[model samples]
Every structure is written in C-alpha cells, then in structure tokens.
Target chain A: MKFPFTSEQLTKLHARIETPALIVWQPNLEKNIADMQALANRFDAALRPHTKTHKSPLFAQWQLNAGAKGITVAKLSEAEVMAAHGIDDIFIANQITQVQKLKRLRKLHERIHLTVGLDNPRQIDLLRPFFKDASTPLNVRIEIDSGLKRCGVTVGNDLVELAKAVARQPFLRLDGIFTHAGHVYAARSAAQVEAIGKQEGALMAGAKTLLQKNGLRIATVSVGSTPTVPFSVRNPAVNEVRPGNYVFYDAMQIALHAAAPEQVSLFVLSTVVAHPVAGRLVIDAGSKALHTDGAGVTGHFGLPVNIKGKVVRLSEEHGVLELPEESTLRLGDPVLLVPNHACAVANLFDVYYLINEALQIKTVPVEARGKSQ
Target chain B: MKFPFTSEQLTKLHARIETPALIVWQPNLEKNIADMQALANRFDAALRPHTKTHKSPLFAQWQLNAGAKGITVAKLSEAEVMAAHGIDDIFIANQITQVQKLKRLRKLHERIHLTVGLDNPRQIDLLRPFFKDASTPLNVRIEIDSGLKRCGVTVGNDLVELAKAVARQPFLRLDGIFTHAGHVYAARSAAQVEAIGKQEGALMAGAKTLLQKNGLRIATVSVGSTPTVPFSVRNPAVNEVRPGNYVFYDAMQIALHAAAPEQVSLFVLSTVVAHPVAGRLVIDAGSKALHTDGAGVTGHFGLPVNIKGKVVRLSEEHGVLELPEESTLRLGDPVLLVPNHACAVANLFDVYYLINEALQIKTVPVEARGKSQ
Candidate 1:
C-alpha cells in the first residue's frame, strides 16, 4: 500500500491536472481494498465496504467486484445513487425517520435488497405506515450504541424494545443488529481502540442473543468502523464487517495507529499559490477541498506528503502551510496533502483524478458526491 | 432581516420537503443584500458582492440588480461559472499560479471584465506568459496583508515591488489594491473588530498612496470581510468592498457581533432521527450538511434555531444535539439549525431551498458550488 508514485512521476502528473484536485493512486487503492476484503475473509465475515468514504459508485463497484457482500451508505440519497448504478444490496448505516424519506426508501426497496438501521420505536412507527401492506417486507437492523454515543441504542431493554417493535410490524422484518465503533478514532492508542472494538463486538453480539431470547429472530450481526474492524471482526457472532476508511487510510488513521502513512491512497494535489513569508506557504486547497473534520482530532488540517510542512490553517479556498525554516518549497510548486479525514475530503470534489502504476491518468466522477439529502 | 416564517409555516414547509436541506428565508436574504448595499452606498464605494458565499449566479444577479458594480469570487472556475450565467463583471479575489488555470482565466477575461488578485512577483511571472500580448490587459489587483497572514504581501517595500512588477507588464493592468481583514473573525469585541477594520483601510490606502508616489495609477482601493465591512467602508480612500458572508450571517458572525441572530438567513432543516438518550437527540444534518467550519470557533457544530439544544458533536451524517433535561424534542420533529459558517455549509449542497414570506418555496442551484479549482 505504499504510495505508488515517485517525486518525478507525481510532479509530472501534477503538471497535467489542475491543483486542488483529488488524486487516487490506483495501485494503493486496489491494495487497500484487497487487504480489507482479505481481513474480512480471515474473520469469516461478509465484507460490506462503506461507500460513505469514496462516495463513488465506481469505487463501490470495484469493492463489490473484489467480493464485498454489499455496500454501506449513510443516507438514502446515496443508496439511491448506488442502486441506480446497479448496486443491488445496500445497508444504510444511519437512521431515517421522516415520512417523505421513508416513502423514497420504500420506492428504492422495490428494486434493491435494502436494510436500514433503526434505534428507536418511533422510527419503526414512521416506517410502518409507508411499508405496511407491501408485497415484500423491508429489512430493519437495530443499531446498538457501541461506544460511539452518536447514534444507536444501548444494548439493554432499549435494544429489545426496539427489536420487538420492528418485529411487531409484519411488513418490517427484523433483520439483525449493527454497531459502528466511531469512537475508536479518538482512542489514544491501539490498545484503547482494541478495547473499544472488543466491547463493540461483544455488545452487538450480546444484543443479538438478548433479542433472540425475547422471541425475536436476528439473522445478521454486524460491526464496523475502519479503526476497530480488525479487533471487532474477531467475534464469531459477528457475520458482517463494514469498514469505510480502509479504502483510503488518512492522517487520522495514521495517528490512531490503524494505518501506516504509506497506506494512504487518497491525496489532494495542491499547488503552492502564495509564499508570503519565509516559513509560510499557502496551497490552493483549503477547507473546501480537504474539509475540517480531522483538524479537531489531529490538530492539523492535513499532512503534506511531499513537503516538510504542516497545513496550519485553512480558509474557504486557501490552505496555509507552515514550513520549516530551511524548506525549499516555493510558489507554483505542487504539494500532495493527505487529508486528515478521507471521507469528508472525498465529499468536496466532483471528480477524482486516478493515476495508475504506469503514470497514466483518468478522471472518474464522484457519483454520490453531495448526495447528502 | 428577521426569519420570515412562523412555526406553522415552517412545520408545513418542513413536511413538504426532505430533511437535511439548506433553507433560505427570502426576506432575510433580500434584506441582508440591501443592507450591505446601503452600507456600501453610504461610504460612496462600489459594492462588488463576493459570490463565494451563496455560490449562486441568481443571487449574484440579485445583488447586481440591487446596485452591485461587480461580483467577486475566490477561484477562476467560479468566475467562469458566473460569466456563463451572464455576470459580466468579476474579480477573482485569489491568486492563480498554474498555467492551465491562467489560460482559462485568459479565455474568461476575453468574454468579460475580469480582475484577479496578485501578491508576489511569481504570480506576475505566471500571468506574463499568458497575457503578454493580449487584445486587452488582464486586470490585476495587488493584495496587501491587512491583518490576516494567510495570503497577500505586507504594505511595505514588498507591496511597492509587487505593484511595480505588475505595472511593468504592459499586458497586466494594475487596476487596484485590496486586502481582506479575515482576522477580524477572531476579534473578542466589536471594538477590536473596528480597530482591525481601521487598520485594514489605513494600510490599503497607504499602499495606494505609496504606489501612486511610485508613479502608478491605482484606480481602486478595497478592504472587506463581513465583520469589518461596517468600519472598513468608512475610509474614503477605499472605493470598493467585497464582503461575501454578509449574505448569510451564521453563528460565527453573531459571535463577532457583526450580525443579529434574527438577520441570519440560512438554515439547515434537519429531522430528529434518533433520540438515543434522554438529553441527546440525533439529527440528520451532520458535518456533511452543516460543515465543520464554525465548530472550532464556537465549540458547537451548529446552533439549533427551533430547539433549545446545542449540536455538541457531528459525524458524517449525524449531528448529536445535547438538549436540556426538560426539552420535548422527539423523533420525527424537524429542527432548523443555523450553521457555524454559512459559506462552508452552502458549499455542501447543490441547491438551496428558498422560502418566501408567503411560505412559497423554490429550489435554486448553487451554480459555482464546487468550482474550487
């Protein structure tokens, strides 16, 4: 998963395309995809790679071609985009409560084998009317709060109650349980991430058992998140793994010890547009290109792959890099930056300039980019 | 500038459209535009409304119809989009160093009156090869570092040298000098913002004077930024202002005392999708919809307009709102959140839902949404 381009190759490639562009090193991307799928195979779990990272149907198709059971999306709009692109199996890893969106989901479920996450009874109530009396029952996976505290219910009475509520609706089939260990990104060490992952697997598996004892049949047990997938997938009770950021391990992944720096496949090709001082260089890619997600976690906007500098500040269209005093970076020079969070960064671009091992370049549309509805 | 919808109106509108949508109150938007225009009129300066905020050519047209002399953009791609939409007058308030983008800029200049910002001799050199022998000179504005150290040359011998270098190129017209006091966003008080604004105006005017003493004819002297516009426009030497964020004031502007809470025009209409805990409610709008810009400055992701809660954390598709103990927000309820930074939030969506005073809604495309190249 090492960066496949040399300095000369990168400079030549950089000259061919526009700055502030998303560049995917094809070899590294394919390797990362293969490595994650192999990991799922080693654990004997279904590899359902999350499309929320790349947001490209082409990349999702690549994952599926490499033996992914299904694709995972965060929004119904993204699922629709993937379904239109012939991705039949999708699991929306987030909750959908609105009736308007539920109607769209019902329409989408007619074509694809869809499964949505639900953590509350109210969401089941919202789905009942729209899905009721349909020829095919919609699949529902109860979300267990496995240390992320963002979404999902705790693995207790709340979990059993939510599962029972989904089971009560004849049109809504209680599929299984899923948990995303998002808090592992904030883990201080690998050991901490392992602990959270172990707890995540245990909680979801335990929740599955608890619901089964309550006369609810749960088919699939899933655990996800890039950082925690290695440890979480060890549980035999878990049948599916959905790790999104593994496709393009970012600076945050490196900080979490979940990935090596060379494994990062995604880069924002930015040109040094301004050298206002001896130690300050400004790149054309700013928050608009790199995003502001990982700066809070990493304390830096992005990591420069080719230069001895740190992206210290970001405006709308300007990324200010603070270079070492002896650095030789100048104006108009290309700087490849590995964004702190690849998922958020991928959402900003309309297309990705993919470079193969032969240094050949091609453009691929980020089909699901801005599909945030 | 008050939000132009009642509770019933908002409830009805929220039900009609999908959640996690960008909503613009039309009355507040129009009033914000007119108020900024009036402020520019009071100072006898031409209002070149920066279209980087709305990224919509229709909004730029509204500003032009309301007496704006031109539109300002941060990228040449944005200028091309605005030009394609018939916004003939444009100033790219950023430096372009790549030859490819410069060629695009040159072609765009042929179709309209185009000006670009310049800070160093390298940019002047980048422009020389493209505009050395053109039908008309490309308008170049020397950027002076007012207070924000992100970009621009200092108002010293460096400024004189940069301006002289621009004047040396016969094909590059030295039309003006400009500076943006972006550091005013960090001002702790209104007085500090006013002080930064005064220094911004004085430095630009001094640069103009120094350049004129060096035998260069500088037609325009400009200073901008939403917070400093009120104080910066008062300087008589400044003839043009480019304030973008005044179009949709957000939580950051309110924190800087530049905007009242009611003057905020933009909102993200999100539905409560998950109530995992008693005090925690998860909304559909996350960093993907609301953006992560203002979270660093305000210590909150976004301010919930209708709900008495703070969006404490945000994932890619979920916003975690921590509400009061007595809060009654439930699943399926719609909450309007004012983003921390409206410009960043606007970049995330392809279209904005504009709601008029009569509760009518229309979709407007963000024409230059991802024109970051």
Candidate 2:
C-alpha cells in the first residue's frame, strides 16, 4: 500500500524500484494496446504508431507484437532507441536535418528499411550522400501541410515539386506522400474530425496523383493522428496510420471522441500530502506528475475525473480540492487523476503503472522516455 | 559527445547515461547560485530557494553548501526527496493534504525540522494529531492570496481568525504569514513587478500586525518569488524571501526582467538530428525536452535558442524549423534553445549535464527528477 508494487514483491526489489517511481499499469496498457490493435484490424490499415507518445521501446515492441506493421518515431534518437530494442522498421515522421543525423540515418539504413519525411527539395539533396553507398537507398516521403500550418509544404505544385525532388535524389527512393491532419485536433465535434479526415485523405491522394502524373511512382499515402485515426483509417488511399495516444488515451482524447473515458489506460495515482488550509487540499503529485499540458481548455487546471471516489483539483505539486464546506480531506488519502493529454504526460516520467480493471499493479519501463535526440 | 559522460569516462565506468539527455550547464549554475548568494548576502536576509525549479538533490546540496538557510519545497513529495538527500531544513510552501502523505510527513518529522504553510482552520485540525506529542510543535504559516488567484486565503479578518485558531490548537504553532505574488510573473516591466512586490510586502506585514493584535505571535513575514525578490527583499517587515527560479532563471523570468538573460543558468542542449527537407529542420528535442510551457499571451515557446541557428516549431520529439524564406539548414548541426520556462523542462529529465561557461561538460544527477511520490 505504501509503494505502487505489492508489499511482498516490493520488499524483494526495494532498492532498485524506488518510490516516487513511475508505476506502469501493465494490464491497462495491454487492454489499451489490444483495443488499438482491434481498430487497426477493423480498418484494414497498418497501425504504425508514433512512439513519441510513450517513447518506450517496450511499448513499441508491444505494438509491433500486437500486429502493427511498423513504428513511427518523431526523432532519430527515438528510432535509435527503438532500433536498439530490435525494432527494425522505423518511420522518422518529422523532417531530418544536419549531417550528424544523416550519418546516423545512413548507419540505420544499413540495418533497417529507413524512411524519412520531408517538406522541401533541399532535404532530398542533403540526404543524397547518406544513401549513395547503400544498395537499397533511403526511402523518402513528401509531407503535405494540410491546414495545421505548422510544418510541411502547402498544397498544390509546391508539394508536387517537393515530391519530384524526393524522386530525383540519386540514392533515395520516393515511397509516398504523407500528411498529418493535425488540425483535426481542433475539431469542433467528432463529425468535424471525420469530415476533416476525409479531406486529409483526399489531400494526400491528390498530391500522390499529381506526382504520378508527372511520372513518379508513389507507393503509399499515409495520414493519421489519434484524433483522425477513427475517421481516416478506413480511407482506401491511406495504407498506414500513426496514432500514438490511442494506446493510452487521455481526457482531451475522450472529449474529442477519439476514445471513451473508460478506454483511457493511463492515470496519475497521487496521495494527499497536506490539507494545510480548508477549501484547499494538497496532494503529493504536482505538475511534475500531472504535467502542465493544457490539452483542451477545461475550466479546472487539470482533467479531474472520478477515480475510485475522490474529485481532485490538480495544482502544481498538490491536487487541490475545494473540500465541501462541510466535509474534510485528511492527509494520506490516495486519489487517481486522469490527465488532460496522455501523450505529453506520458513523456514526463521514466515509467508507468500498468494496472488492470481490477486495480492489480504491474511495472513497465518507459524505454523511450528521454529519446528526444 | 555521444553519451552524457565522455567516452573515456563511460568506458572507464561502464555506465550508460540516457541519451538525448537534458544536460544542465553546471558552471553556469554555480555562477547563478553564487549570484543569488551574493544577493541574499547584500540584503542580509535568509535565502530559502524553492526546489521546484531544478528538483535535483545534487543541486540542493550545492545550494545548501553555498548557504541557503533551508530548502523550500512546493509539495510534500519534493520535501521527501530533499530529505532523502540529507536536506534537513524544509518548508512546505504549499498546503498539505492526503492521509498517506501525512504519514510520510510524520516519518520525515522524526528526522528534520519542518514548517508547513496553511491558510484555514480545518488544516490546523488535521495537523493537531501530528504535533500532539511534540515538545516544539510543527510551525504553520498562513498564506495570503495576493492577486495570483491560485491558492492562499485572501487577506483580512478571515486570515486573522485563522491565525487565532492556530494559536488555540495546543499542538500547532503559528509561525507568521507568507505570500507569493505570482501575478508579478506577468508584469510588463520590472517597475510593475517591483510595485507589486511592495504591495505584497505590505499585505504580509499588515496580516502579521493583524494576527499580533489578535494575540497570535507573528514569527515570520515572508514574501517571495523571483519576480518579487528584488523589491520585496528591501521590505524590512519581510523576514524571509523564497525565490526558487532565481537560481536558474528562465526565458519567461528574463522576459519579465526578473533576471537578465546571462543570469539564466539552465538550458536544454539538443542535437540537429535530421534535415528531411529544406526550410524545415528537425532537432532531437521537442515538447519532451523543452516542455511546451509557452508564455501564454507572449507567444514564447521556450525552445532553447536557434534550432539550426533559426527558430523552429516543436512537435513532440522533433522541432520543425520554419526557416526564413531563403534559409538553408545543413545536416548534423547543433543548436541551443533556451526554454521559455526552465522549471517544467527541468522536471522532465532524469539527469542533466553540468556544462561550464565555455561549454565544457560536467555530469550531475537530477536525483529528484521523478520524486512525485
């Protein structure tokens, strides 16, 4: 009861598995992984999850073992971590720059079928040398900037031009054109997200067509995020979907109708440390645990869900509660908190508690917790 | 350069530090610590740094060795971690709650002197049992809500009544009053923050006088926050100042003019991992490395400066640089990004590199990184 693990097991591994440790609920994670696997199978599309969510090689293995075709990583470091864990197929979904990274890519190319996403022609030229010596060459994809306005080349000839350049890279292989309908996150409703997903699929398909008409062979069209997966996975043009948070959805994901609340597998288990003042109760967990990720503008500071019994208000280090004017919260009560955004919160710690529906606990390593490089 | 420790060192020890690690600039931290030490010396007031910024036991040891009277913890878990690291004098700056946490607090009490901040009568009742057997009761300070609107009881007769209630509890000791003018964080200018600091000091002093008039001994009047410290330190009525971020000022703190950019001791060191496309470069660091704690209205993303020597948009693990219309980023470039908020970013990492001013690296443990209890 004192630590996350059972007292019997805790005593045996007391020194290594320290308290203030990130406890993983394995059963919950297994359920989350199974649910996502079911969705990908139902849609008949590859679930190449973006590993940035949990950044765990173990979780990536779980996903692949659960029938995912490949794993998506946002950084080369994440790919490296995954590679070390024996994940051979990696999709570096973000733009890659710098010769150092290219060298690493070149090395990885020798070991795995490596694909990098790009939004510009210069990147194709930059990657030429890394692939020049390789027999299979590097796989490249042109990323289209669909309404998010964050990255990627905007629609039309600009995207087409980028794609052509990718095809022209002497040692690079132009596999496909991809776009993440990131704006789907701001969807007003689930209906809007689905509509946005359709538009996103069309946009990628349109870009692929433009490239094909210009005499380029586009092998795949990919578009997906946890929010858009439910809407985009069934699209015929899209061969793969990368929805990371689906494995452990959070409150914002639920609000977006990405998953039902019960489907959320991750939570912050906190203890009430102090009730120094009435109307304000402080919990042992703070921003360090719950994180300052304001996924959606909920009136409360964090996503407050009824976990077992307590209604908690998350503060920086203390989840404050405006105790009922009549009721009181004593010190040492444990409360469960579901965060607003699972992805960001998941990245905050080195491990997580894999708890079952019955609340049985298991520890799992967040193998990719710090794989930002 | 590949591992946090040097190749020679890592080879010698066979210890693998996590990669894409959050490396702290150590000599820079020492300078920052010394500067704050000088500040406290100049003002002749005790410096009790809030440990929420760099929750590292190693750093806490450095601060205490350099002459911080005590460590100020925002939560009980942090206090517990610091205590584990031999930091005996601690002040829980926030209210405490949860029964399990109280038990931990009781366990901690057997070892160190603790002062907990409180604002209401019910909190007094909760602490009575813990203090019942004490020869010298645990100290409690009433927190005055001064415009931050986060926590603390608003100053006035209610505060006086609360202090009186504490006086009535035989097991509780009314230490004094404290207020954190967090509103100063949004100050447009130093003059504004200074003025706010004056108002905060007046409120703390006024509350103390009111408590004293009502037969409660006013032992300490503390008013502090990095933004208010420069001004509030001059207030004679304020016996203590708790400014944690000053030890490693951040971009937001610098923007608020609380500290100059040079005073910023901490920064996230990231590598240019990929240049997938021109006009868009990705760094190994993103929301996970430099947390997405943006300056809400100021639009500061808090990235360590220059991703490929240019500003970039951050995705989870990759920072997407939107280069100037004609800019070019080559592969393998290293960039420095000063996060907008250092505290949250620091909290995300398990260990950090301590680099000298010349950028020579010294490794240190972020011992308290995941101490969320």
- Top candidate by lDDT: 1
* lDDT for residue A129 in candidate 1, whole number 0-100: 83
Q: Per-residue alpha-carbon lDDT of model 1 for B1-373, expressed as tens digits?
A: 3445666777898889898999999898999999999999998999998889999999999999999999999998898898988889899999898878888988998899988998889887788888887999999898888878999988778888878888888898889898898988778888998899888888888888888899989999978899988988888899999999999899999888889999999999999888888888999998899898877567799998877879998888999999876468678888888899999999999999998878888999998999899
Q: Which ten residues in a row have the lowest lDDT in candidate 1 chain A?
A: A1-10
lDDT, residue B6, candidate 2: 39
Instruction: Give lDDT: candidate 2, residue A348.
Output: 70
Superposition TM-score, candidate 1 onto the true structure? 0.98
RMSD in order of candidates: 1.4, 6.2
Model 2 CAPRI quality: acceptable
lDDT for each residue of candidate 2 in A1-373, tens digit (9 for 90 to 100): 0123353443333223333334455665788788778887897777888888887887888889999999888877778888997889999987766555677888888998788887767666667777777888788877877777665777677776777766666687888877788777677788998898888877776777777888888887888688887667676777778888877777677677777766666666655554545565555555666665554433344443432233344434555555556333355444455677677777777676555545555667777765565
Listed per prediction, chain B TM-scores read: 0.98, 0.89
